[model samples]
Target: MTTTPALLPPDIRVFERGWLSSNNVLCLGEQATVIDTGHVKHASETAHRVGAALRGQPLADIAHTHLHSDHCGGTAALQAAHPDARVWVPEPSLPHVQAWDEDRLTFGDTAQRCARFNAQHALVPGQSVRLGARDWQIHAAPGHDALAVLLFEPEHGLLISGDALWEHGVGVIFPQIDGSDDFDTFNDTLALIERLDPRVVIPGHGTPFGRADGGIEAAMARSRARIEQFKAQPAQHALYAAKVLIKYQMLDVEAMPHAEFQRWLDGTRTLHQLHQLHRPDLDWPAWLALVLAPLFGKGVLRRDETLVLDGA
Candidate 1:
């Protein structure tokens, strides 16, 4: 975990992982707790880190902000390591997690992976939970993911913001790809954050940002502007979403044969849904070309006759 003493409370330790995985927040307390394990690819490392941090103490709970693959993929691994650690997920997603339904969880549709795990409890909004001697109020954060929740520690003005609020912007509005107009909900979540007025924010994927870095208000303003841009040019947002999916795949594989990557792209339902909804005039091949154009142009990725390589 990186040490950013000025931005974080003494009890919280943040693992600032990059794009492929969500940051892991380790809360030190009498009852040890780990919030948001990273991607499956980093499961072993995550468990090792948590175990080292525990210094032989048993992990009491493993909680998630949401059930997105990157955010919760390491849950199964952690559960295996600490059999008694209770796994908790958002209330709305408890049933799906209990059933281990990849389809219902959107893992299958997004072409992402999350090993099955059991949830022993739900993180419902309007509730409070204790971690590391601090009481955190759980609030529903519904823009990036409808079922997502944020943990706010009022005493220190600390917020554990998942993908719902990031330094740059929020995560891709996933429901949009599935034919849902959730932009308004996303804005509402932003408003909720404003009301919370946190002193420091621990985001899912980046370094913690707070009053020193243009403050939370500045971040909110940037995100609001981005939302308006997407609203005005819905097609642009679709194209951005397409690029994100492709880039995520690239990050997962690092490099893949062009044919294999194409097959995977063809199999991902979200990409097809985005294309059909936004650019139906073009045939599949032409639409794909359009999606790949900027990705290749800006060196976010590179591909030759035989392979696709991650350049970003």
Candidate 2:
């Protein structure tokens, strides 16, 4: 299939943003469109980066796989810069976005920040959108986020798997935390990705990779292991979720005082709910004080008397 060269199509380039934002896929041609706009905190940087990539080209449209804070946080800022740029989001998330409901959109619930933005159009499933000269097929992908979607370009065998199928493993099964059994659906999504047999995958968080079979197989195995582990010990998953959120915040802030970190964790309603369901035995202050231990011991984070640094 000569997958390598074709998979790295010049029209589709990935701007590899770090944690807290998904990679922005730049599809340039007659009308420029960007998939995912990074995080709101880095909106200005994202705009400048994309602008430079375009070389004076005006960004014309934006499409998101999901409404996760990181993926669409820069939408409002980007729209303000290019007021004519059309924004599209998953159809299911249209209402929450239109209402600017941070809670419903999960920013507020998770204690994360996302600039409010309006999506003028919906990224409807079973339809194709023009990203440059090619038509990218949109398919409903519900695993990490119930409403996430995957964009596939058949001719090129390129897939924008979003967080549904990352290079390493799928994103957190957030539906579980929200009291939904989504492991089966997640498995189905992975199977679908495997069936499509993409030559290259531009995932939501990591660098793009080629030859999906090995990665997909490895990721599927890892996912099955994790799912089985979670099924047996749900609390472990809860704790993992808590740590992920903390690490995400630390990635954005780089560092924070212990008091502020504690407060942030305390205020994160989603984490709190996970804790309540799985670790309710401990009181707030006690759990708060001990919760960072595992992450610290694993070298995922570093903590001093008053400060928590990013993997310090």
Candidate 3:
């Protein structure tokens, strides 16, 4: 049976289903280039899809906006499939890629998050790449990650924003972990992007959007609001951590036991320490109290003398 070919958009084709693992795009031309590959779990499939999209044309280059696992995980697989293809990455990420530093890549405690990929080329600001005969400009987009870069096609007024600008806010500003949340820097980057006047924006997550609609503005506003909320209650940091883990695991809350869930919370470094320090205000002995409150209200967990997964 023949598999359906990856979706294409005139000269620019987008594989839009991978939001959590940002969508992939293939630009068909004299020099075929693919913008960002999905997660490692989907790497093989992505390579196959890209190969099919090539349609006998050689894949000259593979470029990544950043080194995030979701953004570059499939690089190795793609290269293995097309041995002639050269991997292109941001200049800052070059050293890490060369040294093969898995730790520096921030693939969580598990290396499973990202696969090893070699960078044969570097994309610096002002550098131009010819995709299907038109030149696309590369710009440094730092804030989410200091090494991140964004691609802009001035002729077509198209921007492959990557994680710098998502449909519903930007990617997590990871620099905050080191106490360097320069909101000003992020704002500057956004302003710089606005000046480009991109007619169409292909974000790292969500659908491709037009600048006319209030989508970009709404996302920026939500990002600012979240930053303010993050500053207000530090406990929200722990909550944010929980939310990320939950989304990653996609756990069926109803199948979780209260005690087991509490144990999971206790195992987390931030959550455990936060519970201990704020014992007076939060009451640690009743640790399961706050933990279950939200889930219980959401009908994800039920409490009947003892906590149990709601549906289970």
Best by TM-score: 1
TM-score of candidate 1 on Cα atoms, chains taken together: 0.96
TM-score of 3: 0.77
Per-residue lDDT tens digits for candidate 1, residues 157-273, read: 899999988888657898776766557888998899989989998889888889656767788899999999988987878888888889988887889998898899899999999
Model 3 regions lying over 4 Å from their true place:
1-9, 108-112, 231-238, 249-312
Predicted candidate 3 versus true structure: per-residue lDDT over 1-312, tens digit per residue: 121223224778778744446588788788788889987767888888888888878888889988887789788999898888888899877888988887677654322267787887888887887755468899998877777889998876888888888767545555544345554566667877888878777877677776567666676677667666655654565455444444333222334455776565555443454454334366665764665467567754455656554432
- Model 3 lDDT at residue 278: 34
Candidate 2 structure quality by residue, lDDT tens digits, 116-232: 887878888999988766789999988788889999999988899888877675467788788765467777788788888888888888777777447656665777777778778
Worst 10 residues of 1 by lDDT: 1-10
Give TM-scores for every candidate, taking all chains together and pairing residue i with residue i: 0.96, 0.91, 0.77
After superposing candidate 1 on the true structure, give the runs of residues whose Cα lies further than 4 Å from its correct spot. Answer: none
In order, the Cα lDDT scores of the candidates are: 0.87, 0.82, 0.69
Question: How much is the lDDT of residue 34 in candidate 2?
Answer: 90
The full ranking of all candidates by TM-score, starting with the best, is 1, 2, 3
Which one wins by TM-score: 1 or 2? 1
